[model samples]
Target chain A: MTLWLSMLGEALQAMSANKLRTFLTALGIIIGAGAVVLMVALGQGTQTAVTKSISALGSNLLIVRSGSAQQGGFRGGAGGLPTLKTSDAQALLDLTSLNTAAPVVQQGAQLVYGPNNWGTQIVGSTDAYLDIRDWTLQSGRPFTDTEMNSGMRVAILGQTVAEQLFGSADPIDQSVRIQKSPYQVIGVLAQKGQSMAGSDQDDTVLIPLVTAQRQLVGSQFKGTVSMIMAKANSAQQLASGEAQIADLLRQRHRIAEGADDDFSVTNMASIASTMAQITGMLSILLGSIAGISLLVGGIGIMNIMMVSVTERTREIGIRMAIGASRKTVLLQFLLEAVIITTTGGLIGILIGVGAALGVQRFGGIAVAITPQPILLAFGVSTLVGLFFGLYPARKASMMKPIEALRYQ
Target chain B: MSDIIRLAAIKKVYDTDAGPVPVLNGLELSIAPGEFVTIMGPSGSGKSTLMNILGCLDTPTSGEYWLDGENVASLDEDRLAEVRSRVLGFVFQGFNLLPRIDLKANVALPLVYQCVAKAKRLQRAITVLERVGLARQVNSLPPKISGGQQQRVAIARALVTQPRVILADEPTGNLDTVTGQEIMTLFQDINKESGVTMIVVTHDARVAHYARRLVYLRDGLITYDGSAADFQEALA
Candidate 1:
């Protein structure tokens, strides 16, 4: 053990003597390790963000969209043409298996508050929209039932709309004109950042469903709504809730058996699973790139060590003559290689973490870094050193002292 | 006195693509403890091969060889390394000190292989360096010191292990005449004072005169082996 320690000391001395060369030799390893750490951080970070966005979408939601329109047998999947009614959403709330059902209608309009006017999406939903979305108000309160029933002109401003119109001032009790109609702002929704679709969630203005239906978007049909978003009692009930909704809607519509209903019910898990698959594949791709770079780094180490062993032939001779055994010489060179990779690994991890945080700060991307991946990166780099170093060290130890002494 | 080194019919040959070539043929020689012996010969006289064999760096092709009371001719590579560290100290013509290390580290090289504690070995190295008149240069790198001081550091390294036999191969070949004589005199003093055996190989007759005993080799055979004074007198 003492001998090994002393050998380590000597290896350090040799490395310190050629600091620039050592670092250059380890550059590939540095890049490889850095890529590995960054890949893990970004991969895990993206998954977390996806999950957060999914949950931010709603509480275990099953979204119901109107079926595709058939025009001369040319069907496009963009089928959001509003065939469901607000009555259907109200009827879904009768099912005990559901937590809440929010009927929604949407339109884009220019919102004007005094001298400030900004174009944004206007969401018309029942008060149950807040419960289904897990949404909280930053100020004031949700619209009352009598207000929604009477089609009163009360509104809740999304954070971005409030910020644009008020700029950190209290927006409650202020009046905003939507499509030239003045509505009093009753509440301001809390910040929700971006949704899973990468669209800004806070760039909206919310109004009661009946008010939007009567005054804003529902002039074509008597009681039409764009969609119904229903929440299940729990995750396990989502499938059954979807089935029950399908059966109940079919029966309500009085559609015959074997006929395609004009409405579609989708389980949110499928969306989540698809998102998970994309992120999982992304992590694997990033990991493979890192693995390939590590392989190249191992080769780089091997190449440099070969040159080092050849360059230090005379030194090996001197050591051998001074009673250094073959094993000792081999161990010495191997120790040097390991030290290089370990040092490079540490530097790479530092750079990766720094870059990850930089992305989080400047690029506005979420990145997660944990200890296990760091340890894995470090361990793999060390193993690469040992695996690649063995051949060159073996060559050094195999030299005969007489010929090595004569080496110039 | 029991001989510290024994060689009986030791033979070494090289297998070349041209054919086999014999280097040492049926050589027999021995020297007692505390004796200083120098082997003198011209180039290609098999003197270096004999030095390598004596230092345990190479084994003889055939025959029995004993070093410090142990049979080492048939020992494996690791055992030879062990024997080299425990019983032999070596000096080379070019003063083969590892240039990257300081005098203390160079002198402690053998003990490093022997697994000696760093502090103890370094302390012993400093003591031996002081004995070689290099106390002031103990921490100096080999390239920073003069050729003579470098050779002195090499000598200190050889003495650091305090081995039974110190083998020097043309120890003063790179030095000036004055520096050469000084190195030879240092070897003589070390042999006399420490009671350690000294075997030096040189082509210079003047350097050979420092040894109390002399062996002369020619064509892989010993031409003369006797006291240095009588060999010189007979040649004269």
Candidate 2:
């Protein structure tokens, strides 16, 4: 071990004698490691952001959307099918397996507050909408059951809509007009920002289902519901809940057992797990692509080492002639290669952590730079140097002492 | 006197495309400890090949060669390296000091292969460098020192291992006459002080005169093996 230390010391002295050459040789390894770290960080950051957005919708929840019909040819969009009705939501809510349920209807129109006008989506839902969406109003409460039943004119403004219509001023009890229909703004929801799908949660209005069905949209859209959302009692029971709801809806609609159910239901936990799996695969793919660059870096180390062998042929002969074994000569060069790569790997990891932190600070996403990947990067780099450095070191060691000594 | 090295019926043949060529053919010789010997020959007279064999850098094709109480002729490469490190100290015509290392480090390099302790190796190296009159230049690199000084450092390196014998292959080949004579005087001092045997290979008759005995070779045969004075009288 002492001998190894001395040999390593000598090798380091030799490398240090040529600073620019050493630095340039190390550059390839640095870039390879840096790319690996940064790519993994980006992939992980995107996955985290995506997961947070999905988790915001609450666990154990499922959304059932109306499905399109297939014609004699292919299907396009919903295929102008008859819309879902409030009765379907009612039937699903009556099921004992469900936690809470709400039916939704949506319309987009120009909203006017004072002289300022902005186009915004207006959604119609029952009082159960707050429970299903996991939302709580920040100011005055959402309309009560009586208010929803009586079709009272009140509105809950989404954050962005509130900002556009009322600025800093509280919109509670203020009035906003939609399509010439004036309504009292009852509350402004807490900022929910945007969903994973990039839709602005704060850019919409919420009102009672009956009022939106009658006043703004008219009878032609009566009995037409866009979607139904409900929570299961627990994630374990979600599948049973979905099955029960599907059977109930089929019976209510009087559809046959073998026929297509004309609807689709997705559990939130399953969606989140699936998204995480896809993201993890993406991270690995990107990391492997960066690994190719590391391979190239290994080749670069080999190239430089071959040149070093040629340049130091006389030195090798001197050492060998002085009593250095072939293994000693081989190990000296291998140690040099490993030192360069391992140091480069460490520096690259530091840079990666710093970059991830910067992205978290600026991008407002929870980007975690874990130690496992950093260690992995470093380990891979040293192995690369050792593996690729072997051939050149072997070539150097195999040289005849006489030939090496005579080499000019 | 103890016979430190012996060669009996040794032969070294090289295969050429044209034919086989013999460098050393059935040579027999012996040398005792604490003796100074020089091998002299003209160019291509196989003197360097004989030096290589004597230094344990090359083995005879067929021989019963013994060195320092061991049969070194049949030893493998690694064993030969071991013999070279433990039994022999070597100086080269080119003054082969590793340019990257300092004088002290170069002198200490052999002990590293021998697995000597760092502190002891450094101490021994410093002592040998001082013995070679290079104590003040211990930290200097080979290129930074004069040609005579570099040869001194090489001598220190060869002597620092404190082997039984020093094998110098044309030690003064690259030095001027004054530098070369000074180097020979230093070698004589080392041999006289340490009581170690020295074998120098040289074509120059003046360099050979520094040795107490000279072995003359021509066409792979020893033509004369006697005192330098006897050869000088014969030439005159």
Candidate 3:
């Protein structure tokens, strides 16, 4: 232990004598480690942000959308595509397999609440939409089934739309116009913020499906309902619900065997799994890119170490000829390399984590500084030093004692 | 007197670009434990080669070289280094004290190689330096001192190991007459007081005068071997 400490002291003294060169040599490694950690943090941050947004849409909700083709071939199967209708939703609701089922119609239009006008989406659905969206009325009551069935000219505004329309005034019972059609706002939804897809949930307005179908468009036969929403009783029952829904939808659409279904059913469990997989993959991709910089830094360490070996050739010879074994010499140089690179790696990890914290603290997005990536970068940095240091240490140890004594 | 060193018919050859050149040929010598001997010869007379062989830095091509009854010629390179560390000390003409380290560290180097404890090695180094009248210069570096002082430090380094013999290769070759005499008097004092056998290689008669015995070599062969009085008589 004392000998090793003396060796380390000597190495540090030697490096201190040439401070600028040593710092410059270590700079590459620092940047490499820092970049690796930064990439991982950013990747993890993005994934977390995306996952948080997706989870906000409620856990047990599954969405079914129209497939690419239609059974009737109307409008070249673009508009008349095979879709989930009101009947499919009712059927799922009536079954003991599902918890809740709702049909939806979506329309993008310019909304005018008093003098303030904004481009927003208007959704038409039953009262069950609030549960699927994880929303509650902020102040007033929600729309009733009577309104939904009778196609009443009553509306429910999302938090953002209500704020813009009414400001501090109560938006409930106030009137808002959707494309020249004035409707009384019966309720205001709680702020649900943004979805995982970057769409603002609070920036929308909702009304009865029949009102939207009758007053907004006069019911032109375009296709099946836009989408369907349903829920399973529990997470464990999700798979069974999915299987039952798929079978029921398949039978209702009456597709023959070997024919691909014309509709897509997206279960919440599967959607969450798919999204998590994508986030994980993206995180790894980004982390690997950072890993490349560390590799470059390792190469830099090796290159500079080679130069150091050449410069200290006589010193190496003097030590070896005195009684230092080849292994001793090799270890000395390797230790020096490891010392420089590991220090750089440690500093880089700190900087990466610090930067990640800074982003999290100041920036609106959440930043994740995971320990696994930091440790991975650190281990890789040491390996890089060892890998690069071997060649130079070998060269130093291979020098003949007599020739070393002869070297000026 | 105790016979401590012996060499029998030791020969060394170097293969150069020109061809093989023999440096030592059929040389036999021995030194008593407390003897002070001076080896004198011309530049190419192979005195340095003989010194290297005696120092255990190089091996003879053939013949038995023994120190204290151990045949050094049979020892491997690592064992040879061990022998050199424990039994033999070397002082080169260049005063090859490591300049990068301080005088104490340089002197402690051999002891370190011998795995001496730090405190004991340091204490012994100080004692040897004091013996050589270099006690005050213990903390100084090689280059920071004069040529004579550097050689004295080298001598202290050699003596710190408590070797049986000190090999001084042209000990005064790089010093002035007065400094050379001072160094010679130091060597004679250590030899008389500590009973350390000394072999000094020199070309100058004055430096050779300090040796109790003198050997003259010519063309890789010893031509005269006797007491200092006989060498003076032969020169006369």
Candidate 3 per-residue lDDT, tens place, B87-157, comes to 88777677776666788877887776666677887899888888888889888878999999998998888
Per-residue lDDT of A351 in model 2 = 78
What would the per-residue lDDT of candidate 2 be over residues B1-236, giving only the tens digit for each residue? 26898988989998899899998888888999989999998887788888888877788888978898888998877778788889899898889998867899889989988888878888999998998888898889899999889999999999988899999999999999999999999989888988899999999888988989999999888899999989988888
lDDT (tens digit, per residue) of candidate 3 on A89-134 = 7888865668897788788878787688887888888888888767
Docking class of 3: acceptable
Local accuracy by lDDT, each model:
0.89, 0.85, 0.80
Off by over 4 Å in 3: A53-62, A67-83, A93-100, A108-119, A126-156, A168-198, A207-224, A231-244, A256-262, A266-293, A320-322, A354-367, B16-19, B116-141
Report per-candidate DockQ.
0.70, 0.63, 0.30
Residue A230 CA error for candidate 3 (Å)? Answer: 3.8
**Which candidate do you rate higher for lDDT, 1 or 3?**
1
Off by over 4 Å in 2: A54-61, A67-82, A94-97, A109-118, A175-186, A220-224, A233-244, A257-282, A352-368
Residue-wise C-alpha lDDT for candidate 1, range A212-298, written one tens digit per residue: 998887577658888899999998899889988998888887778997777899888778878888997887788778878977988
| Top of the candidates by TM-score | 1
> Over the stretch B1-236, how does candidate 1's per-residue lDDT look in tens digits?
28899999999999999999999999999889988999998889899999999989999999999888888999998888888888988899999988888899899888889888889989999999999999998888999999999999999999999999999999999999999999999999999899999999998888888998999999999999998988888878
Lowest lDDT sum, 10 consecutive residues, model 2 chain A, at A74-83
Task: State the weakest 10-residue window (summed lDDT) of model 1 chain B.
Answer: B1-10
